[model samples]
Target: MSGVRLVMARHGETAANVQHMLDTRPPGLPLNERGHTQAAALGARLAADPVSAVHASVAVRAQQTAAPVAAAHGLDVRVVDGVHEVFCGELEGRSGRAALERFMAVYEAWWAGDLDARLPGGESARDVRDRFLPALDGILDGASGDIVLVSHGAAIRLAAAALLGDTAETRFLPNTGLVVLRPDGDGWALEHWDGAMPVAGDVTAGGTPA
Candidate 1:
């Protein structure tokens, strides 16, 4: 097996993020000004790595976030399928506290190993994993060296936890925050998560948001 490291990043900020909306849809909002700066910083942060490929989901924000990093490596940001955010379904565009709580409640359920839990009119944890794992495999198909993928928060958290058989290293995935993984036997080993090694029993938050 190759020593290829997978770096999964959450997309930069968007208006919806600031508003606390469940903004999960294809071709969703673009990154705001601050998001642009974060994108550049993320690019610079990873430029020195031997990044062989850069990828993004279908969301506009995700693509925008991957642009700088791909440019840094002289690589095109491959717009991939099935690696987007967790679909919010009926909660899409809803920013109310009740809806947000409901969504998080179900998301929390997935974190508790209840993969069948689904948001009303949305995907289940099992649904996310089925589509995501395949998309991730396809992204890795015939690929090598370091790779970067700009995606979403909950999606990244769910997938990474499932892949590593560990609880999410952090609860949030702030804009451009990274979750690094390396090949280990038939699975993967969690490397630096959200830019640092998490301490056991630590209840970290913002440090993980993206």
Candidate 2:
């Protein structure tokens, strides 16, 4: 294929996730038992691809999730700094209705193009793009076959919106959820998201597959 097929997935849940707490700090948390199962399932599902490269965030959760997938391809997971989870800063470890709402508000604004918006003591969406895009582009440019990027939820979501344009169906990728992207000219095309793939000639120019 002339284009790189990028399979970007979110890391499985963590104890923080289970407790609804924001866990984006360094030397990140390990995956819980349920998270491990989810990782295994993710690996099993994506094992069919002839994965040429496997990349993950510096976070432990991401590395853990990428482990099985990397093993399937007999490749070692490469840690990419830029792909780490959004630094929620002040919100770290704070879990509650208000905290969550505030976190989601920033994301909503980000999706709506408010790249400059930032949570207290945290980075902006633009910050994420600056770091994330280069790492992602490096992978796309260097990979010879399909590749998988095990990244955090917010980071991956922002990259998809920035690189592939906004798609309602992919507004959020659940833990271990993935979306497939293919280079389209100078832009990228969203081929699959939220477990749905596009049927050829059945998709609109807007990129929604029937």
Candidate 3:
């Protein structure tokens, strides 16, 4: 049976991302200059495909990132709260270096397959996976043609891990990177990861944007 194609891309860089800050709060800052360029590039790349839908996290950066692509495809950008970045809680608005240090500590535990280890007042990796996968499953079940999901790094990583049936370490997707998955039976199959940007005019077997 033919299955749905899910094209997931990380949001463009934000001012916080460029300055190495932790932006976990609502209405966080918008994208920086380079971030706008990146989003434009991503939109140009995605224009080659027939994107039936564009979904984004509700964060300012993510919404800004999805705007260009949605406009290019003539699709309304739907904000899905479920795909928001993991809540950093106390770490919100902290410097990126501090967040990195803390993230590394959490990552170490994640590498050891400990899903419960979490930053203070934040969701665990397992928590992210649990929330995101079901949302993704619903998207897949109802979607046809090509669907573009613009989301944060951590949430996208957890969802990719769930789809690929791998640990967190196996799911390192770069900012603005693209991961394409196709529904397979009751699960999903990873068709490509960090593949060429669609601007290069590369189309996958399932006609998804990469």
| Model 3 pairs in collision | 20-96
Query: Against the true structure, candidate 3 has what lDDT?
Result: 0.71
- For 1-210, candidate 1 gives per-residue lDDT tens digits of 386999999988888878777788788899999999999999999999989999999989999999999999899999999988888788888875677667867866776778899888988978988888899998888888998889988788878988888554555667888999999999999887774433543332222122
Distance from true position, residue 191, model 3, in Å? Answer: 1.6
lDDT of 3 by residue, 1-210 (tens): 164578888877776765566676666778788888988998999898878889887787888888999999888898876777777767777763455567656755755778788868887888888878777766656678788898876677667877777642344555677888877787778787883322321111111101
Candidate 2 lDDT for residue 174: 71
Candidate that scores best on TM-score: 1
Q: What is the C-alpha lDDT of each candidate?
A: 0.82, 0.78, 0.71
Determine the backbone clash count of candidate 3.
Answer: 1
RMSD of each: 3.4, 7.0, 7.2
Q: Is candidate 1 or candidate 2 better by lDDT?
A: 1
Off by over 4 Å in 2: 166-169, 195-210
Q: Considering every candidate listed, which one attains the maximal lDDT?
A: 1
TM-score of each: 0.91, 0.88, 0.85
In candidate 3, position 13 carries an lDDT of: 73
